[model samples]
Structure formats: C-alpha cells, structure tokens
Target: MPHVSLHTPIGDVTVFEHDGAIVALDWGWVEDQAQTALLDRARQQLDAYFDGALRTFDLPLAPVGTPYRRAVWDALCTIPYGETRTYIDIARIAGGSPRSVGQANGRNPIPLIIPCHRVVATGHLGGYSGGEGLPTKRWLLALEQPEGALL
Candidate 1:
C-alpha cells in the first residue's frame, strides 16, 4: 500500500492507495509523518478543497470491499457535490432497503472523496465515521452547503 498524509480543515487526512487506486481516506487529528509523490498531489488537492477553491476531487481510488459494498460506493459517487441524500433515497437508488444502505454507508472507506458524509437521516444529520461525531458531520455538510440549502 502507498499512503500519503495531507492537511485539511477537518484536520489531517491519510490517503492510502493500492495498485494505483485509492483504498482509503481517513481523517485524524494527527498522522504518522511521511511523504510520497502521491501524497504531495493529494495534499495540494485537499488544501484546495479546504480553502473552498476546489469542488471535486480528481484522484484514483480502489477501496477494497464486498461486491455489494463496492456497488454502494460506486452509487455514492453519483451523488453530486453539495447535495444530500437520505438513506431511503440511496436505498431506492441502489436497489436495496434503507437498512442495507445504512449498513453500506457505515462501511464507506474513502469518506470525503466518495462523499458518504452527504447522506443524512430522514429528518436529521446522520452518523459519521470520523471520531468527532455529528458535529463533524454537520460541519462537513455546512462546508458543502454554507447557506443551509441542502436538498
């Protein structure tokens, strides 16, 4: 695995790649300091994003998971930037029930790039993998939709 760590508004992000595609993107308060060519590019992009200069990520990712999980991740990327989708909505789109979508969403590896944070509960902000909990989730949603115009 090839890994790189970069800074972001949410803090340090560690992007791991396997066989030329990203396998995971993790958020942490601190990360093991190491640098790579890929890390440099990822850092640049992440900085751009946090600075509100970039709206989309253009990085190769290959998260390893079951077929269903892979399908879920693929469907997740279809979710446009600055938009939120309910678990039920994603369930119908992914051809599964809401509970299944929740399961898959919990397993999303590349969080921000895949944009799993864009999914919310039917009437509230949903869970987040990052340790900061709902506040982090709320902050991310706010970053994507600063005016509270999430739909």
Candidate 2:
C-alpha cells in the first residue's frame, strides 16, 4: 500500500491506495509517506475539492466492507454536493434501518470522497467519525453550501 498525506482546511488528510485503487482516507499525517501517480491524482482532486473548484470526485475507490455496508456507502455517494440526506433516506435506499445506515456511515473508510458528511440525522446534523468529528463535518457541509448562503 502507498499513502500520501496533505494539508486541507479541516486538518491533515492521508489517502491510502491498495491494488491501484483508493482504499482509505484518514485524518492526520503519516510518518512515512509513499507517493504514487494515483496518490498524486487523489491529492490533486482533494485539493480542488477543498478549494471549491471541484464538486465530484473522479477516482477509483475500493473501500473494504461487507455487502450491506457497501450498499450504504453507494447510497451515500448518491447524495449530491451541497445537499444533505437523512439517515432514514439512506436506509430506504440501502435496505436497512436508520441506525444501521448510521453505523455504516460511521464506518466508511473514505469519508470525504464517499461523501459521508452529506448524510444527516433528521432535523439535525449527525455524528461524524472523521477529522475533528462534528466540527469537521460542519466545515465540510459548509464548504459545499451555495455561495453567500448562511452556515
């Protein structure tokens, strides 16, 4: 596996590659960095995303998870940038309960790329397991918000 870490608005993010596909993205920098063409592209895309120049990611993602979790993650990806969906909405799409959908969301290995922050609880923001937790999630959601909109 090769990994590259880069600075972002929220914090340091490290992207991991396995078998030529992006496997995971974690908060904080890694001590030993391994750069590859794929990793470089992922970094560039992430930079563009944080800069608000890119709305969609164009990378191969191979997040390891169970079938159900994969289904949940696929549903998460359907959530458009700058928009949000309730956990119940994901459950409806993924054939699971709200709680199960939330669990899968929390377990997502690729947070920003998978767009897990776009999944919210009904009437409120939900728990986030990446970066600085709720604050990071809030920042990500705000980043995608339409310009001039209130955060």
Candidate 3:
C-alpha cells in the first residue's frame, strides 16, 4: 500500500492506495511511505480540494464494503457540493434506513472523495469522522457554501 499525507485546513489527510485505486483517506501522516504516481495525483487533487480550487474529485476509488454499503456510498457521490441530503433521502435511493445509511457513512474508508459528509440528519448538521467531528463537518459544508447562497 502506498499512502500520501496532506496537511489540510481541517487536518492532516492521508490517502491510502491499494491495487491502483484509492482505498482509504485517514487522518495523520506516514513517514517512510511508499509513493506512487497514483498517490502523487491523489495528493495534487486533495491539495486542490483544500485550496477550494476543486469541488468534485476525479479519482479511481474502490472502497471495501458490502454490497449494501457500496450502494450507500455510491449514492453519497451524487450529492453536489454545497448541497446536502438527509439520511432519509439516501435511504430511499440506496435501499436502507436512515440509521443504516449513517452506519454505512461511518464505515466509509475513502470518505472525503466519497463525499459522505454531504449526508446529514434531517435539519441537522449530522456526525463527521474528521476534524474533531461536527465542527469539521460544519467547516466542510461552509467551504462549499457559496457567498450569499444562504437564504
């Protein structure tokens, strides 16, 4: 596995590569890492994302999960930047309950790229697995919110 660590505004995000696709994005850095062209590209994209130069990620992703969870994660990808969907919305699309969607979201290995943070509780900020939890989720949503886009 080759991994690249980036220091973003939220925190250090390290993307792990396996079998030529992004497998995970965790917090923190890895010293004496195995670097690859794929990893280098992922690093560039993540840099662009943190800089707000990129909203959607275009990378090869193969997150390990069950079929049901895969569907949930795939549904997460459809959520546009700055926009949000309730767990109920995903439940309808992905064939699971709100609790199941949230659980799947929690288990997502490649989170940021998968855009799991876009899934929220009804009228609530919801939970986040990064940047000290909900604050990080808020920061990410705020990052995507356009100026005056607010009502």
Overlapping backbone residue pairs in candidate 2 total 0
Overall local distance difference test of candidate 1: 0.77
Clashes of 3: 0
Residue range 1-151, candidate 1, lDDT tens digits: 5677766677777888676667788775344555666666777877887777778888887888888888888888888778888888887777788778878988988888888888888888878877477787887777877564753
Per candidate, the number of residue pairs that clash is 2, 0, 0
Sort every candidate by TM-score, greatest first: 2, 3, 1
* Tens-digit per-residue lDDT, 55-137, candidate 3: 88999999999999999999999999889999999999999799999999999999788998888898777898875898888
lDDT of 2 by residue, 1-151 (tens): 7999999999999999999999999999997899999999999999999999999999999999999999999999899989999999999999989999999999999999999999999988989999879999999999999988975
For each candidate, the alpha-carbon lDDT, in order, equals: 0.77, 0.94, 0.88
Q: Mind sharing the TM-score for model 3?
A: 0.95
Candidate 1 local Cα displacement, residue 20, angstroms = 1.1
RMSD (CA, angstroms), candidate 1: 2.2
TM-score of 1: 0.87
Best candidate, lDDT: 2
Candidate 2 at 71: error in angstroms?
Answer: 0.3
